[model samples]
Target chain A: MRPIPPWPRLRRGLEHDYTILTVREDIVADPRTGQEHPRVRIDCGDWVNVIAVTREDQLVLIRQYRFGISAVTLEVPGGIVDPGEDPALAAARELEEETGYVAGRVVALGSVHPNPALQGNRCHSYLALDCVKAHEGHPDAGEDIRVELHPREAIPRLILEGSITHSLVVVAFYLEHLRATAPR
Target chain B: MRPIPPWPRLRRGLEHDYTILTVREDIVADPRTGQEHPRVRIDCGDWVNVIAVTREDQLVLIRQYRFGISAVTLEVPGGIVDPGEDPALAAARELEEETGYVAGRVVALGSVHPNPALQGNRCHSYLALDCVKAHEGHPDAGEDIRVELHPREAIPRLILEGSITHSLVVVAFYLEHLRATAPR
Candidate 1:
C-alpha cells in the first residue's frame, strides 16, 4: 500500500431535474494505472444533511414516509441542494421549510456520500443552533412529515435498539458527539 | 415535541434503475398500526453493508471509483446480499471478492436504514475477523479497488475530517467501538 492509490477522475457529466430531489451522473475515469486496465468508470451523488438544534437543546426532527423504503421514518430535516445553491444555505432553507425553525448560527459539520458506489450525491451536514420557530408548517404535496424533538443523550439508546434508522440522522448525532468531545 | 408523532406513509414508489433511485406508490391502511391506507407508495429497495476486520487488528478496506459520487471511495468490502442470501455469508463473499481476503469468523453487528425516507434499503453490517488472503482480487467492472489496512483508531480521524463519508462505514466503526469499549 505504498503511496495509497491516487483516484483521478478524467471527466464528469452533470444534469438535474427540478423534482423533489435532483440526480446527477458523473462519467469518471478508471483508476487502474496503465498496463491493460479494464477500461471502466462509475457515477456518484451528494445529499445535504442538517442538524437543527432547538433553543431548549432538543434536536428538531421530521418524521415522514420515505418513498424509497416505504416506511415512515424519522430524519433530521434536509434535502438536495439545487445545482447552483450553496449547501449551507440549502441546509438552512430545508430545515425551515421542513420543520418551521430558524437557526441563529449555522456551522458546517462535514460532508458525506449517501452512497459512494452507483449514484451521485453528497450529504453536506450542518449544525444549526439557537433555533426559533419561524413559520407555520407547509409540507409539500406528498409530504406527511410530522415534527419531533428529542433529548440529545437518548440517541445511543435509540440507535442500539433500532429506533432511529435514517442514515443522515445517525451520522449527524455522531458528528455532534465528535464536535462536543474531539480535541481542538 | 411531546410524545413523538406516529409515523404515517404519505407517498410510495419503486426504483430499479440504480441512477434514478426512483420511487413508486404503495399505500397501506395504518402506517404505525399496520392498518390499510389506500394510497400510492414508493418502494425503496433493500441494501447490504458489512464491517470486515482482519486478524492483524487492521480493517480491510476497498478504495475504488464509485460512479454515483464520481469520487474514489474507501469502504469496507460489501454489497447487497442476493435475495435470500444470509447476510453473514454475503459479508464473507464480499470480503473475499472485493479484497481477495477470506474470513475465519463472521459476527452480526446490526442493520440500519441508509435513509429511511428515500431508501427502503436495510444496511446490514457484519464483523469479520481472523481473515487471510484467499485469492487474487476480483472486483466487478472497472473497479480499481486497492485493498488497504487501517488501524482501528484511525477511523475517528478519518470520519471527523470527512474522509470516511459512507454512512455504513461510520456505523460499522461505531459498532466496533461499542464492542471494544463495552464490558468484556
Candidate 2:
C-alpha cells in the first residue's frame, strides 16, 4: 500500500475550551486537490483503562452516572493520563483509586486513538493481574462510582447483552481477548 | 446492583457549534451531595460502521485521512446516520458509498455509545456478508480514501499489531467475534 500524503494546514486557531476538552479549528488543503477545507479537532490529555483481574479470575468493574447520556454505565476503571505521567502508571493509579484494587503485576495491553477523526489523543488499555482489594475507593469530588466484580468469562456475554456499552471499555476487552488467544 | 440515580440537570445551554459536533454546557446537581457542577456534552447524529465480508472470505477495509489525528488511518467503512434513517440501512449505504461494495445481506451486530461520558450518540455496527464490488467508490468531496481487502482471519493480528487502531472499528470486530462465538 502506498503512503497517503497528509493534508497541509493553511491555518489553525483555538476555538473553545470546555474544561474537559479544547476544540481547535483548522483550514487544511487537500493533498490531491489542493482545496482548502475547514476541520475541527478536539484536544485533550491521553487516557488509560485497566482490565483488572483478581486471583479468583473475577474482573473489577465500575458503575457510574455519565452526564452525556444522563444514565449510569458499566465500565472498567479509567481516567486521563496526567501530564508527565506514564500511561502504565496512570492505569495502575486509576484502578486503585477507583476500585481500591491493587495489582500484583500490571502489563500493557494496547492503545488506540479513541476517535482519530475528531480527537487527537489516545486511550491506553492495560491488564492488571492478581488484583486484591486494598481499601475503600477514593473517587474524586465529581465522581460517584460503584465497584463490582464479575467472573472473567462473563465479559463477552455482558458486552453482547448491551450491559457494557462503552466503546473504550469494549476495546480494552478486545485487546485482552487478543492477548489470551495469541499464540505464545 | 443497586440503582444509581442520575444527576439532575439544573440548566443547559449551547456552547459551541463545530459543524460536525455541537457542544452544550449543563449545570447538573449531584444526587448525593446536591452540589451543582458544570458538565459538557457533545451532540451529534448516530453513526454506523460495516464489517463487509466478500464471498471469498476477505474483509473490506478502507484507509482515509483523519484530520483530528492528522494521519491516514485504516478503518472500516462508516459515517453518520441520517435523521430518521434506519441504522442497518445506513451501515449498508456507508459500505457501498465508501467502498463501492454492495452486500448481499446486512445484519445488525450491536450498537454502542461512542463515549457515554461525553457523547450522547450511539454507533451502530453491522455485518455485511457476501459483498461484491459494484462500482468505484463515491467519497464526499472532503474525503480521500483507499480501499483494501484482507483475509477475515487477519483481523486479530492486524488489531494486535496496530495496523487497525480505530476504536469503533475494533468494537465492530469485537461484536462480530461475540456473534461468532455465541453458543446456539
Interface Cα RMSD in Å, per prediction: 5.0, 0.8
Assess the local accuracy of residue A19 in candidate 1 as a C-alpha lDDT between 0 and 100: 40
Classify candidate 2 by CAPRI docking class.
high
Candidate 1 global TM-score = 0.78
For TM-score, the strongest prediction is 2
Instruction: Give the alpha-carbon lDDT of every model.
Output: 0.69, 0.92
The C-alpha stretches of model 1 lying farther than 4 A from their native spots are A1-46, B1-45, B178-184
Question: Top DockQ: which candidate number?
Answer: 2
Off by over 4 Å in 2: none
Per-residue alpha-carbon lDDT of model 1 for B1-184, expressed as tens digits?
4333344554443432323244344454343355544442223345555666778888887776665554667788887677788878988888888889888899887778876654566777788888888887787665566888888778778899877888778777776565555544
List the lowest-lDDT window of 10 residues for candidate 2 chain B: B13-22
Clashing pairs in 2: none
Per-candidate clashes, comma-separated: 50, 0
Q: Fraction of reference contacts reproduced per prediction?
A: 0.63, 0.83
**Best-fitting candidate, measured by lDDT?**
2
